[model samples]
Structure formats: C-alpha cells, structure tokens
Target chain A: MVLLLVAPAVAAGIVLLLPSARAIMRFCAMGTITTATVAACCAWRTFAGGSLQAGEWFRMDMLSAWHLVLMAGVFSAVSLYAVGYFSKELESGAFSRGKAARYAALWFGAMDAMTVVLLTDNLGVMWVGIEATTLLTAFMILTHSSPASLEAMWKYLLMCSVGVALAFIGVILAAASAESAGLTGAQVLSWTHLLDAAGSLSSAHVKMAFIFAVVGYGTKAGLAPMHSWLPDAHSQAPAPVSAMFSAFMLNAALYCVLRSLALVEAVTGSDGWGREVLLVLGLVSVLLAAVFIVGQRDIKRLLAYSSVEHIGLIAVGIGLGGAGAAAALLHAMNHSVAKTLSFMSAGRIGQAYGTNDMRRISGALHAEPLWGTGLLLGIMMLAGMAPFGIFLSEFLILKSALEGGRYLLAGALLAGLVAVFVGVMRHAIGVSWGAHEGIVRNVGAGWLDRFLVAGAILVSLVLGIWPCSRLWHVLEMASALTGGMP
Target chain B: MMPLVDSVHVLILVTCLLLLGSSRLGACIRTVAIQGIVAGGVLPWVSSLHISMQLLFTGVFVMALKGIVFPVLLSRAMREASASREMSPFVGYGTSLMAGVLFFLASLWLGAKLPTPDGVSGLAVPTACMMVSTGLFLIIARRLAVTQVIGYIVVENGIYALGLAVAHDIPVLVELGAMLDAFVAVFVMGIAIFHINREFDHMDSGRLNVLKG
Candidate 1:
C-alpha cells in the first residue's frame, strides 16, 4: 500500500529528467501504467482478502479499492490520450518540453495525492490529500496560459481552496464527535475506529459535520450552485486535463463526500438524513446542468455541464441507498469511460476546426472521421442511450428509486435526463454531420488512438450488456461498505 | 490556560475586524499576518490533550509560515500589482466593520447551539466561526484579488483555530500536510496574481468575467 503512494511521487520526480516533450508524454503513459499495475494488485488483494493496511495510517477496503480500480483505469486512458492530444501542440510549437515536464510532474503528483485520499484511514489525511490535488492541478489548467485559461485557473484555485477549507470544519467536527465518544490520539481521526464507535457518537455533531462536508466537497465535485468553476476550467484547460478532471477528479471529490456520508449514516443509525442531503444536491445538479446544456455554445463547456449532470445522477443513486448505491458505483465507471472518449474526441475535433463553438464548427464527420465518430458515439452514450453502460446504470438507478417508492424523485430525475438527452443530442448531431465551409486538415489517428476509442466503446457496451457476476459482486461489496443498505 | 486561550481568541477576532475595516491593502495584509500569528501562537495552549514536543514544533512551524512567510508573499504580490488602497470596495469600510460585528454575534449564537467536548474553551468555537464568516465576507465584498487572498488566509486561520479547539489529537503528519497545502495555496495564488496582473494590467477579480455563461 505504501508502495502505491510512493511509486507515483517517485515517477513524478523521474519525469523531470526526461529529454523532450514527446519523451515526457511517453514517460507519463509508462508511469501511469506502472502505478495502475500496482493499484490493480492492491485492489485485487483487497478483493481476494478483506482489506489491506499499511501501518496505522493507510488502508483500503472494498470502497477505496473500487475507487482505486476506477481511478487507475481513467488515469491510464487519459495518460495515453495526452500523448496524442499534445502531439498536435508539439507540432504547432504550443507545447514546449518544459511545459510537458511540468504537466507530467503535476499529473503524477495528482495521482499520488488521490491515492493518498483513497488509501488513508485517517479522515484528516484524506482532506489533506484532496487539498493537495487542488493545488497541484491548478497549473495544469494553464498548460497554454491565455487570459481565459488564467481566469479559469484563478477561479478554480480560489473557489476550491475556500470550499475545501470549509470541509476542514467538517473533519474537525467529526473528530470532535469521535473524541467525545472517548476515542483518543490517532484513533479520533481514523475512519474504522469512528465506524466502530458510531453508536456512541454525538449525532448532532455528526449531522453538522456531514452538512458542512457535503457543501464543501460538493463544491469540488462540481455539484451545482457551487459548480461555477467546472465549465470555465473545462473549457479552458487542455483536453487531457479536462478529461482527467471530468473523469476521476470529480469522482475523487465525490468519493470524499461519500465517505463522510457513510460515517454520518452510521452515527445517526442509518436513518437516511445524509442520503437525503445527497439526494437534494444530486437533483439540483442534474436539473441545473440540464438548464445550462440547452444553449451552451462552447463544446467543452457543454461536456463540462454533462459531467455535472452525470455526477449528480451518481449522487442521486447513492442517495437512494440500496441497489441505488451499487448502481451509483457502476455509473461512476461508465461515466469515466464515456467522458474520457468524448473529451479526447472533442479535443481533436476542436483542433481540426480551430474553435470549440458548436455552431461554428460543423461537418465533423467530413473533417476528421475517426474523432468525429468518437465524439458522436461518445455523446450518444453519454445521453444514456441503450446498450451503453451509462444507460444501464441510469436504468438501474431509476429502478431502485421506483422500488423504494420515491416517485417524485424518480419523476424529477427522469425529467432532467430527458431534457439533457434532447439538448445534448441536438448539439451532437449538428457537430457530427451539419454543413461546413473550409476543408479541415486531417490530424491522422495513430493505432493507439484507434485502440483507445474502440476499447472504450467496447468496455461500455460489454458492461452494459453483460455486467458479469464478479463485477456485480464487487459493486455490492463496495456499496455495502457505504452502509446505507436496509 | 483557558483565559489565555480566550484572550488570544479575542485578539484574533480584533485582527479580523481590523482586516475588514482597513481600506489599505498593505494594512489588511499586516492585520491578517497578525491574526495568523495569534492563531498559531495560541495553538499549544488550546490543545484538548496534553501538549507534546511535536505539538510545540508544529505550532512554531505554522506560526512562522502563517505569520512571517505568508505576509511577505502577499506583500510582494501587492507591490507587484501596484494597487495600493482598496478603492471603493463593494462594501464600505464602516459597513464592513459593522458586518464584522454582526458576524461575531451570529457566531456566538451558533457556538451556543453547538455542543463542544469537555476541555474546549467556551470562546474558541465562536471566535473560529466569526473569523470564517468575516473571511467569507471579505472574499465576497472586496474588489481586489489581493484582498481575496487575504480573506482566504483568514478563513484558513479560522479552520486551524477550530482544529486546535476540537481535535488536538490530529496526527502531526496530517497537520503539517495541511499547513504545507496552505503554504502552497498562497504561493500558487501569488503566482496566479502575477500572471493575471501581467495579462489584464489590473487585479480586479470582479472584472474577470469574460468566461461567463
């Protein structure tokens, strides 16, 4: 477990010694692969055995292990896509070796920090890990610093910093509740220890803590009302960075919120107060994203809003709490896969067309067929079309909500999803096959690019169609760890 | 020890009011620096558990970073930006000061509602809450980016004080890690301010509205 955290930091250091921009990008891919391999081992061990721990600080159970596997998959895919995405910049002289080195280092640093968030048993350390990710990735957003990117970077840095700082109040309160329950020293901050002592904890303190936590971490997770930074940052950042942010970073923040919800539910005797908070935030996020997606001009911002929508759905699923939690975990995986492909394709398509404005850039299929199809299918999948993992997950969430007799919640969610489907499909169809002017110079796709796009589609398809028993079992174990099941 | 902690908390609250009322950026930076020092200096005395060598070391470390280093960084950023006084803040100085007092009263009310552990000083939660509210007010009500950074520091200072009040048993490693994050946050914000000033020729964050919906 220690090695999982240490390897990425070491890789970050090693990347600084690389020679050229291309070399740095390649090194990032290799580094991510190595770390993912280590993570897979840890996750497998957690699955085979019960949990894994290193000393008193770091531990991984079914919950973190599940997130660990998803994070590794997303990071690996995004790292490979970074190589392709930056290659064009390399030719255009926009990407320098220095920039590449810095990006690679921050990439690894973010990976390491998130690993700490997932592996650490101490909630304080987890909070630290999340903060470190915010600081580390601030620069990556400005990979090609323009006025707009700088603006995005500033808003991101300030909003997330202040917001996550509020989360510290939550952490402190949780600690207070545990300490009031007679835990001492490091035990006060340990999640496992707090879970054991949840029965004796002060419910009032836990309630306050959970509310503060949802708001604070919810800000970082791009839950609405606090999601102002999401679109701006996504629109301005280089594509791979946007993918990483959309794919795993938001989930990581949401993961922290989920961890807090688990504790809150346990302390309050699982009466669903915490889940109710999540449900409200989740619904707000979905409906709000639907509103924003309707007339969005910037394609990247459109995808960004879609991210808020998907994350909202996941939160709602977890909020529904039985099969809903399991469905939420599955939704997380589906969203990561589909979102990665969409960002990569939109990035390339934007590069070909010289703008991200959906109305301005058309005939995507005529311009670059490979990425255009990727974007089209990716958006189709994202809109929760059948035979895709997202559709499956959304269906399952709705089923669970119906089973639980949350008719109002289910109706609202269905309304939001249908609105988003119409809004996004309009933009997607226009971008894919609508009329255009000048011939877009083809940026030829490499074999790896083809492989990535095909592989993502295949994964989404298979997961939707099959969802093997092993996967379902693992999802159940992870959701069970969340402890809201009746 | 209780009285000492409470007095320092009052001193910290006074600095927050000074920060809100001061129109000059330089003075605001100095006031926050003083608040940092007071907040950090009171850490050892405010522990709910016995203070150890590690706790004292952590306290001095935070004090130096928050009190000494962060002020220097903010001052340098301010000089580079060359915007001296906060000209016509969204809220005037007198009103901001009034708002600060109202925040204190509200925090007191909130503190009464919250049940603290046995060893906690009565004023700690209220003081921390006041600092957090005033800091948030500064962020929303100020025009200059530099002031916003100061507001962020005050918010963090409040959180640190809260940590001291409630959970002194937090692992030293995690505490230092949090402090490191705070340091880097300020450092990163300073660099961002430099870039923003260069690009836009002003640090008025309110005018950074080009990327809106």
Candidate 2:
C-alpha cells in the first residue's frame, strides 16, 4: 500500500532524468501505467479482503477502492493521450523539453497527491491532499501560457485555495465535535474514530461542518455558483490536462465531500439533511449548466459546462439514496470515460481547424473522421443518449427519485437533463456536419488515439447494455459507505 | 499569559482592519504579515495550553513562514509587478473599513452562537472569524492580483487560528502538511502574479474577462 503512494512521487523525480520531450512524455506515461497497475491490485485486494490500512493514517475501503480504480483508469488513459497530444506540439516547436519535464513532474505529483486523498483515513490529511492538488495542478493549466490561460490559472489557484481553506474549518469543527468522544491527539481527526463516535457528536457542530464542507469541497467539485473557475480552466488547459481535470480531479474533490457526507449523515441519524443539501446543490448545478450550455460557443467550455451538469447529476443520484447512490457512482465512471473522449476530440478538432468556436469549425466528420465521430458520440453519451452508460445511470437515478416519492425533484431533474440534451445536441450536430470553408490543418493520429477512442466507446456501450453485475455489487458496497442505503 | 493572549488578539483585529483600510499594496502586505505572526503566536500563548515538542516546532515554523517568508515573497512579487496602491478598488477604502467593522460584529454574533471548545479563549473564535471575513472581502473588492494573493494568505491565517482554537490536538504531521500546503500555495500564487503581470502588462484581475460565457 505504501508502494502505491510512494511510486508516483518517485516517478515524478525520475522524469527529470529523461533525454527529450518525447522521452519524458513516454516515461511519464509508463510511470503512471505502472502505478495504476499497482493501484488496481490494491483495489482488488481491498474489495476481496475488506479494507486495507497502512500504518495508522491511511486506509482503503470499498469507497476508496471504487474511486481508486476510477482514478487509475482515468490517469492511465489520459497519460497515454498526453503522449499523443504533446507530440503535435513538439513538432510545431510549441512544446519544449523544459515544459514537458515540468508537466510530467506535476502530473506524477498530482497523482501522488490524489492517491493520498483516496487512501487516507485522516480527514485533515485529506484536506491537505485536496489543497495540494489545487496548487500542483495550477500550472498545468498554463502549459502554453497566454493571457486567458494565466487568468484561468490565477482563478483556479485562488478560488480553490480559498475554498479548500474553508473546508479546513469544517475539518476542525468536526474534530472539535469529536472531542467529546475522548479520542487522543491525531485520532480525533481520524475518519474511522469519527464514524465510530458519530452518535455522540454535537448536532449543531455537525450541521455547520456539513454546510461548510459541501460549499468548500463542492467548489472544487465544480458544483454551481462556485463552478466559475472550472469552465475557464478547462477551456484553457491543454486537452489532456483538461481531460484529467474533468475526469478524475473533480471526482477526487467530490470524494472528500462524500466522506464528510457519510459522517454527517451518521451524526444526524440518517434524516436526509445532508442528502437534501446535496440535492439542492446538484439541481442548481444542473440548471445553471443548462443555461450556460445553451449559449456557449467554445467547444471546450461547452464540455466543461457539461461536466458541471454531470457532476450535478451524480450528486443528485447520491442525494436520492438507495439505488440512486449506486447509480451515481456508475454515472461518475461513465462521465469520466465520455468526457475524456469529447475533450480529446474537441482538442484535436481545434488543432485541425485552428479554433474551438463551434460555429467556425464545421463539417468535423469530413475533416477528421476519428475525432469527429468521437466528439459526436461523446457528446451524445454525455447528453444521456440511449444505449450509453450515462443514459442508464440517469434513468436509474430518476427511477429511484420517483420511487422515493421525490416527484418534484424528479421533475426538475428531468427538465434540466432534457434542456441540456437539446442544447448540446444542436451544437454537436452543427459541429459534426456543417459546411467547411477553410483549409484544415491535417494532424495525424497514432495508434494510441485509436485505442483510446475505441476503448472508451466500447466501455460505454457494454456498461450501458450489460450493466455488469460485479461492478454493480461493488458500486452498492461503496454507496452504502456514503450512508445512502435504505 | 492571559494579558499576552489578549494583546495578540487585539493585534490580529487591528491588522485585519489595517488590511481592509490600507490602499497601498506594501502596507497591505505588511499588515497581513503582522497578522500572520500575531495569529501564529496564539497557538503557544494561550494560558490553558500544554506545551509539547510538536507544539513548539509548529509555533516556530508557523511564525517563520507566515511572518517572514510570506511577506518577503509577496513583497518581491509586488516589486516585479511594479504595482502599488489599490487605486479604484471595487469598494472604496472608507466603505471597506466600515464593512470591516460590520463583519467583526457579525463574527462576534456568530462566535456567540457557536459553542467554543473548552480551554480556548472566548475571543479567539470571533477574532478568527473576522480574519476570514476580512480576507474574503479583500479578495472580492481588490483589483490587483497581488492583493488577492494577500487576501488568500490572510484567509489561511484565519483558518490556522481557528484550528488552534477549535482543535489543537490535530496530528503534527497533518498540521505540518496543511502549513506546507499553505506555503506552497503562496509560492505558486506569487509565480502566477508574476506571470499575469508579464502577460497582461498589468495586475488588474478584474480586466481578465476574455473567457466569459
């Protein structure tokens, strides 16, 4: 377990020894793949043998295991894509060896930080991990620095920093609430001890902690109002970085919120107070994203808004409880896969057409078949199209919401989803089939691109149709940890 | 000890007001640096506290980083940006100072409502809350990116104070980790401000409005 945490930090340093930019990218990809393989093994052990603990500070349970696997999966895919993505920049002399080295180092550094977030039992340690991520990934948005990218990086760094600092207050309050539990130093902030002593916690303190945590971590998780930094950062970052941001980084922050939600629900005796808070934030995020998506011109910004909507959907799913929580977990995975495809496609399309404006870059299918289809299908899946994993998860969430007698929530959610579907599909259609007037910059794709696109599409299809029983069982186990079980 | 803690608390409150009312970037940076030092001192100065090796190490580290290192870094960034005085702020200095007083009263009300943990000073919670509000207000009302970074550090100081008052028993490792993260956060923000100044030829963050919906 320690090896899983230490390996990435080691790889971050190891990339410095590489000879060239290409070599650095390949080395980093290989490094992430190796660490991801180890993470997968640990996750398997956790699921089969129950939670695994390291020393007294770190532990991996079903919840962390689920997120661990998701992180590993997303990182592996995006790391490979980074090699492909940066190669084009390399050819154009846009990406230098130094920039590549920094990117690779920060990439591994972020992986280590996120691993700490997933594996730690200490809530304070988790808070530290989230703050570290905000700092480490801040420069990644400025890979090819511009005024806009700098603006985005600045906003991301300060907003997330201030937001996560507020979360520290929540952690302190939670620890103070646990003081009555008589745990000694350090253990007072341990999630396990807090869970064990949840019943005796002061309700008012717990309520305050939950609110601060949701708003703070929710800011990083790209929930609405606080989601202002997200679209700008996503649209400005290099495509692979943006993919990783949308795919796993946001989920990592939300993972912190889930841990807090579990503790708060336990303290509140499962009266759905925490869940209702998530429901309102989730719905607000969905509606707000819908409003933005309808008028967005930048393709990357559109996908970024879509990420907010999907994150909102996942929050709503978990908020609905029971089967909804499980469905929400599945939705997280599906959104990661589809988002990776869409962002990668949009990035390559932008590279070809020299712009990201949906109206300007048209006839994508004619210019670049692979990524055009990827973007089209990716957007369709993100819009919760039938025969996709997102659609299945969305259906299950709505079903569970109705089953739980939340007709109003169900109605509002359905309306938001439909609005997003129409809004996104219109753009997707024009971008995929509209007329092309200018000479396209033909960028060649390697086997890695083909493999990623094919793999993501296949996974989305199989997960939608089959809804594998093993994954569902694990999802249920993880959702149960979130206090969403009936 | 009680007298010392009370004086340190007063120093923190005064620095917060100074931060809100000061128009010059240098004064704002110095005010926050002093605030950080005074706030860091609270962890060790409280009379009801027990001292350990960990607490001693944390006190020295916090004081060194917040009081000295952060100020040096921010001052350098300000020099590089060649920007001074927050002219034409979103909220005028007089109004900001008035708002600061209102925020302090609100913090006092909030502090009274929330239960203060045993052994902590009665004023600590309200003081920390005021720091948080002041930091947030500066972030929202300031025009320069450098001031925003200062605002962030002020917020970190507030949280650190809150942690000391509310949960002093946090593991040393976690506490150090949080502190280190804050240090790096300031470092990174410093680099960002430098870059923003070079790219836009100004530090006016309010003008960074190219990527809107």
Candidate 3:
C-alpha cells in the first residue's frame, strides 16, 4: 500500500533525473504510472470482496477501493495518451525538451497526490493531499504561461485553496463530532472510528460538518455556483492535464464527500437529511451546466460544463441512495472513461487548428480523421446517446428516481439532459463537419493516440452494451459503503 | 475569560466590515493581518479545554503563518503588482459595507439556531459566519486579484475560528498540516499574482474575461 503511494514519487524522481530523450523520459514516467495502476487494480480486486485494510495513517475500504480503481484506470489512459500528446507538440517544436520534462514530472506528481487523497484515513491529511494536487496542477495549467494561463492558474489556486480551507474546517468539525463521543487523535479523523462512534457523536456538529463537507468539497468537485474555476482551468491547461483534472480530480473530491456522507448517514441512522443536500445541489449543478452548455463557445469550456453536469448527475444518483448510488458510481466510472477520450481528442484537434474556438474549427475529419472521429464519438457518448455506458448509467438514475416516486426531480433531470444533449451534439458536429480550413493539419493524432482513444471508446461501448457483472458487483458494494443498498 | 473571547470575536467582525468597505489594497491586507493576530490571540483563551502542547503548537503556527507570514507575502505581492488601490470595485465599498451588516444579522440569527456548546464564547459561531461571508463578499465585490487573495485568507481565518470553537481536540498534526497547506496555497497564489501583474500589467481580475461564456 505504501508502495502505491511512493511508486509515482519514485518514478517522478527518476524521470526528473533521466537524460531528456523525449521517448526515454516519457516511457519511464509511463512505466511507473502503469505500475501504480497495476497495484491499485490488485488492491481494487481484493477489496471488492469487501475487506477493509488499515495502516497507521491510511485505510482502504469499499469506497476508496472503488475510486482507486476508477482513478488508476483514468490515470493510466491519460498517461498513455500524454505520450502521444507531448510527442506531437515536441515534433512540431511547440514544446522544448525542458518544458516536456516539467510536464512529465508534474503529471506524475499530480497522480501521486490524488492517490494520497484516496488512501488517507485521516480527513485532514486528505485535505493536504487535495491542496497538494491544486499546487501541482496549478503549474501544469500554466505550462505555456500565457497571460490567460496565468490567470487560470491564479483563480484555480485561490478558489480551490479557499474551498479546501473550508474543507479543513469540515474535517475539524468531523473530528470534534467524534471527540465529543470521546475518540481522540487519529481516531477523531479516522473514518472507521467515526463510524463506530457515530451514534454518540453530536448530531448537530456532524450535521454542520457534513454541510461544510458538501459545499467545500463540492466546490472542489466543480459543483455549480462554485464551479467558476473549472472552465478556465480546464481550457487553459494542456489537454492531458485537463483530462486528468476533469476525469479524476473532481471524482476524488466527491469521494471525500461520500466519506463524510457515510458518517453523516450513520449518525442520523438513515440517508434522509444529508442526501437531500446532495440531491438539491446535484439538480442545481445539472441545470446550471445545461444553461452554460447552450452558450459555450470554447470547445474545452463546453466539455468542462458537460463535466459539471455529469458530476451533478452522479451526485443525484448517490443522493437518491439504494440503486441510485450504484448507478452514480457506474456513471462516475463511465464519465471518467468517456471524458478522458473527449479531452484528448479535443486537445489533438485544438493543436491542429491552433485554436480551441468552436467557431474557428470545422471539417476536422477532413483534416485529422482519427482525432475527429474520437471527438465525435466521445461527445456523443457523453451526451448520453445510446450504445454508451453514460446513457445506461443516466437511465438507471432516472429509473431509480421514478421508481422511488421522485417525479418532479426525474422530470427536471430529463429535461436538462435533453437540452444538453441537443446542444452538445450540435456543437460537436459543428466542429467535426461544419465549415473552415485548419492550419496544422493531421499532425496531432499519431497511432498511439488513435489506439488509446479507440480503447477508451470501446470500453464505454462495452460497458453500455453489456457491462461486466463483476464491475457491477464492485460498484454495488462500493455504494453500500455509503449507506446505499444494492 | 469569555469576555476576552467575545472581544476577539467583535474585533473579527469589525475587520470583516473594514475589509468589505475598504478599497485600498494595502489596508485590506493589513486588516487581514490584524484579523489573523486577533484570531490567533483568542485561540489560547477561547477554548474551555486546558491548553495542551498540541494547542500551543497550533496557536504559534497559525499566528506565524496567518498573522505574520501571509500578510508579508501578500503585501509584497501587492507591491510587485504595482497597483495600490482597486480602481473601481464591482460592488462599491458603501454597498458592500451594507452587505456586511446584513451578513452579521444573518449570522446572529443562525448562531441563535445552532445551540452553542457550554464553555465556548457565544459569539464564535456568529463571528466566524460573518467573517466567511465578508471574505466571500470581498472575493465577489473586489476587482483586484490581490484583494481576492486577501479575501481567501479572511475566509480561512473564519474557518479557523470555527475550528477553534468546535474542534479543540483536532490532532496537532492535522492542525499544523492544515496551516501548512494554507500557507503554501497563499504562497502559490502570491506567485501567480506576480505573474498576472507582470503579464497583463494590471491586477484587475475583471479584465480577465477572456475565457467567459
């Protein structure tokens, strides 16, 4: 378990020390991330049997294990695609060797920090890990240091830091709640300890902690009204980093929320109070993203808004509990795979066009066939079109809602989904087949990119057509940890 | 003892209003510094629990970082940004001060609803809530990046006070770890401010409308 944490740091150190052959350095970085992914997968498979493992400072349970697998899968894919991304940039003289080195180093660093966030049993340490991700990736967003990139980095740092500071207070409150029941030190912030003492914990203090947890971590998760930082940071960042940010970072924050939700639910002895908060916030985020998606002009910004919507849906799924939690976890998994593909393809397309402006790009298929197809397929999948797991997960969420007799909630969610679907698919096609000449043609999507994008799409398609029963079982068990019964 | 804690809480609210009403960047940073010191000073006396080594450490760490280290870094960034005052705020100072008063009333009402634990100062929750709202107001109402950073620190101080009130048993390691994280966050933002100033030649986050919908 410790090696899972240290492997990336070790890899980053070696990558930093290696002579800067573009292929050599990237391969070394990829190799270590792959190792970490494998370790995480092993842990995931074992933990799926519902075993809980505890270290002195960290713990692995169903919730963390599920996210560990999802995060590792996304990180592995991004890293492989990143090789292609930076290679194209390098060949085109867009990135110097040193710049590429920094990207590789920080890429692994960000991965390491997120891994820590999932693994830490201590909520405060988890806050530190989230803060560390902010710092590590803030630089990643400023890889080019354009005035715009600098501004993005500034807002990302400030907003996330402030959000995270509030989260620390949440952690403190959580600790206080547990301590009022007489737990101390590590046990105060330890999830299992809090769980054990949930009944004796001050319900009001836990309630306060849970609200701050929702708002604070929700802010980091790109929840609406607090999602002001997402679009800028996502758009300004390099595509691979943007992919990681969208795919894993937000999920990690929500994973923190889920940890607190379990505590809150146990204390209250049901899912009524805190889950309502999640449901309402989830609905607001969906509506907010739907409205923004209609007026979005930047391609990355569009994808970013879509991310907010997907995150919201996942929130709603978990908030609904029972089957909804299972669906939400599945949706998180599906969104991770689909969204990474979109960002990678978008990055490729943007590089080829020298712009991310939707109006400025068209006929991407005519310019770069592989990336263009990936972009189209990825967006279609994300818009919850058929034959994609996103569609299935979303359907399950609405079904669970209707089954539970949440007609108004279901209706509002369906309406938002339809509006966003039309808007996103229209914008996606407008880029792939609309009208314009692109300058840097056909240079982006190398064979590696094609393979990775195809692999991601294939995964999404497979999950939709017939998801592995094993995967469903894992997600079900994971949801159960958060007071959901599958 | 409780009165001393109440004084600190009152002073924090005053700082919140000052920050909301002041347009001068330097004054806001200084006011945040003062808030930090007040917050740190109240820490030792406010907790009904006897001071432990962990409490002592958290006090010194927050004082050094929030009280002294952060303000110095923020002021230096202000100097480097070269803009000393917000040219025009989104919400003018007068209106923001009104918002501060309303936030105070709301916090008082909220504090009344959530029963305060015996032995803690009654004003802790209200002051913390007001400070958080004022910090958010500064972030939304001010135009300068530096002021936004100042607002962020204010918000953290508010959360810090809340932590002090409700969570004295928070492990020393977590407290120090959190303070360290906050310090590093401010440091990174300060560096970003320097870059934003140098690149755009101004500190106005309002003009950062390039990536808007």
**Per-model CA lDDT versus the true structure:** 0.91, 0.90, 0.84
Model 2 chain A: weakest 10-residue lDDT segment is A176-185
Candidate 1, residue B47: lDDT: 44
* i-RMSD of all predictions: 1.0, 1.0, 1.5
Docking class of 1: high
- Top-down TM-score ranking: 2, 1, 3
How high is the lDDT of residue B37 in model 3?
77
Ranking by DockQ: 2, 1, 3
Preferred candidate (lDDT higher): 1 or 2: 1
- Native-vs-model 2 lDDT? 0.90
Compare the candidates by DockQ and give the number of the best one: 2
List, residue by residue over B51-161, the lDDT tens digit for candidate 3: 766666667777788778988998899888788899889998889989899999999997776667668888888888888888888888889988988988888888778
**Docking band of candidate 3:** medium
TM-score of 1: 0.98
Provide the lowest-lDDT 10-residue window in model 1 chain A: A434-443
Which of candidates 2 and 3 reaches a greater TM-score? 2
Ranking by lDDT: 1, 2, 3
